[model samples]
Target: MLKEKVALITGSTSGIGLATAHVLAQQGINLVLHGLVSATEGQALANDFIAQYGINAIFDDADLQDVASIERLITKAISTMGSVDILVNNAGIQHTQSAESFPLEKWNAIIAINLSAAFHAIQFALPAMKRQGWGRIINVASVHGLVGSVNKSAYCAAKHGLVGLTKVLALECAEQGITVNAICPGWVDTPLINDQISAIAKQQDSSFEQAKYQLVTAKQPLPEMMAPAQIGEFILFLCSDSAKSITGAALPMDGAWTAQ
Candidate 1:
């Protein structure tokens, strides 16, 4: 069903977003790569998909924090690839600090990128999806959406709000041929996480391995960091015809983080 369809994935320059783009492309889907990366880098990534998959693709370096930019991305993507049948809200950022010590600017930024961007994208994409009578809206939330942790006030709040929005939107679109859902992933061994581990090592004055181990096993009993491609594959499944009935669900890719 994904064949020839267009999927605009936010934050597609690297990590899970990029991985998801590859899987979607493999399924014969066209793409619109969106991220904060340079235009050159973004176009290069888009060209790679076109060269490898022989599918239509383009890059948009839109500032997700700007509602207008988000709208332009969808508009341009539709003009480029025909229509956006799949909308992946995957762009995100993180800042860890005590709630009391959390910078107001950081909190606002997190809420804007992590939460509001999804809103703007979905709002803009919904009409097209509803008009076509078939679409998938996947919000790349985090394990923090389901549960809380220390020193992650802004991220936690934004993710929680995302999950809530996912449910509400799913309910509203339940009758429509559109599905809205959230994917709550655990610690994936991405660059974003590697940086966090480095910070942990620095603060604790410990080896990288020690900090990595502690961080991975802190709540996730699996004691292993998941691969970014795994999340991508899972998303592909959600976009499949089999997952048409799945909506308003907050599926966890965490290794039993919330289980404990």
Candidate 2:
């Protein structure tokens, strides 16, 4: 369904971003991969996509914390790939600490990358999408966007901001053949959670299996982590013609995390 379309996914080197890239490539979409990785590593991923899917793939190294870097990366991708019909703002960072003790610099950094970067990407990509009269902006938000958690002040704040941005942008583009939405995923089995899991195990003096189950099932009724590929598939569905009418929605794949 995505044949001849071009997609730009930030943080595409691994985890959700990489899985999304692979899923989109399978649909014959050209790819613009972004991440903080060695140039050679990025190129290698690009080559693999090209070889496996016969779709054009390029890589750009971008620092989400820097607006200038994001602008340059989007410009380069547009110049090379012709135009970006799909943009997935998947780049983010997390820090767990009490609000009172959270470093100001760390808070700024998390907000910059998680919240501000999505705004920057949309601002840069919107013009081209407007010209084409068709586009999709998928923001990879989290369940934290809809609910609160202790020791995650910055992360939750940024995600909540992203959710708000998604709604506004979706409304603005509602009649313009462009759709904007945020995917609020619960706990996903990604590298980002690996550290937290290990820490939980140490803190609780529990086995890895026990820790993993507790970490997600404590707040989420579901005991399994949502797979990255499952999220990618949902994105593919959203990009389809059937989803043209769906906009301004903070759809959750949270395994009933917010249902409570």
Query: Which lDDT tens digits does candidate 2 get at residues 1-260?
Result: 57979999998999999999999999999999989899899999899999999999999898888889989988998899999999999988989999999999999999999999999999999999999999999999999999999999999999999999999999999988899989999988998788889999999999888999999899999899988999999888889999999888999999999999
Q: Where is model 2 poorest over a 10-residue stretch in terms of lDDT?
A: 187-196
lDDT of 1 by residue, 54-153 (tens): 9999999999889999999999988777899999999999999999889999999999999999999999998989988999999999999999989999
Any idea how many clashes model 2 has? 0
Off by over 4 Å in 2: none
Q: How does each model score on TM-score? A: 0.96, 0.97
* Clashes by residue pair, model 1: none
Measured with C-alpha atoms, the lDDT of residue 133 in candidate 1 is 91
CA lDDT of 98 in candidate 2?
99
- Candidate 2's TM-score reads 0.97
